[model samples]
Target: MRDDEDLPFVAALYASVRAEELAATGLPEAQQRAFLDQQHRAQHAHYRAHYPTAEWLILEIGGTPIGRLYLDEWKREFRVVDISLVAASRGQGIGGAVLADIIAAAKAAGKGVSIHVEKHNPARRLYERLGFVLAEDKGVYDLMEWDMARPSDQGASEP
Candidate 1:
């Protein structure tokens, strides 16, 4: 989980995720970087204020920072607030491993695991493959959920 010292890395991770999208704006490099930095700080503050008790985790590989995972375990469900990886870290199965762990923990506690995924996000496929089904559609995003109590062959084992 993150502590005060991890904020810089967390902000960098956030900026990395938006690099491509911000680039598309045709803004100057300096401006784009500044905008991303400001946005990242605001987002960090928003998450802290809203999900005060959420676990803020930094995903590292060989001591190198690669991604971030934020989770909130409520009385009835385990909510995945956010999970993001740098471009170099994507498609490496790290996310699946982390999510599998979360699933196992949720199962042990008899709680469902849920995440809100953006409408066209690639991660949606990963969620579906891991047994998360659409619970609701919030226009821009869809609420996906996996209940441990449900009977299925997709039980948490691997992947």
Candidate 2:
């Protein structure tokens, strides 16, 4: 997604997810905005720093961008700051395909790619199918890693 066009959408998405949709759940507008604003600045800064040598990507289904993946190459090991597909697009293999593409792209760059999935998300299966393993936990998120060129992945391929 073009930052120019999707920044607002992305910002909204970030706000909604970070607040678990408090904006639409009768929470005060001011409080909702504050929660979202706090997350956006922190996440944006993290993305910028890690993205200096990496790639930022968005996945579209039809004409709508349904997912996003940010690969961090500024560090020795690659990492994904975020990966999300629209809720309505879930369970239709879009997440897998988008992540598969990200994996291929990161592997081509010769880095072990890692992603953090929220504890309550259901995408863990897709990640496991792609050979990503649990690396650690951050209270509310599970950090996972995938080494595409590793021996354990000798027979792995995008589904």
Candidate 3:
């Protein structure tokens, strides 16, 4: 976990799922390296962007941070702008369970919940099952949202 290479499992997950699409539009090897270098700096610079004004949660198993879910209100809905699990730890129901919990919480808060899933992401099925529909499609990713609770069953964000 010390070196970025330790994220091979995570990288592999992304690669195996979309290597062809990525290679077709992404940079060459050296340029990709430079891009990653720039991304490292940008991630640090925009750390706060990872957590918006809405409720955010860290997905952890046994106290280890495996992933994150950021929620922010927009147009009366709570949007999950980002979510990523360690490659080794994905597909074990963590993402789905966390998603369900977040949706439940959003319902109680009188806010709808949404997230963007890549076109080829395996998690897309989970979202669909959870009642998310295509709110928008940005070519690479789809904006999915759900308004589960009726007005009578909802209120405001919990303090």
The TM-score leader among the candidates is 1
Off by over 4 Å in 3: 1-31, 40-56, 149-159
Better TM-score candidate (1, 3): 1
- Identify the leading candidate in terms of lDDT: 1
Which window of 10 residues has the lowest lDDT sum in candidate 1?
150-159
Tens digit of lDDT per residue, candidate 3, span 37-121? 5554564335345644654455678987676555666767777866667665677777777777777778877788888778887
lDDT of 1: 0.85
> Residue 35 in candidate 2 has what lDDT?
73
- Going through the candidates in order, what is the number of backbone clashes in each? 0, 0, 0
Every candidate's lDDT? 0.85, 0.69, 0.63
lDDT (tens digit, per residue) of candidate 2 on 1-159:
435466776776666555655645887878789877877878877777656655567667687877666666634456777776666666777666666666777777776778888787667767777788888988989898887555134223323
Instruction: Report the Cα lDDT for residue 70, model 3.
Output: 52
Q: Tell me, what's the RMSD of every candidate?
A: 2.4, 4.0, 7.4
- Tens digits of per-residue lDDT for model 1 on 89-111? 88878788788888888988989
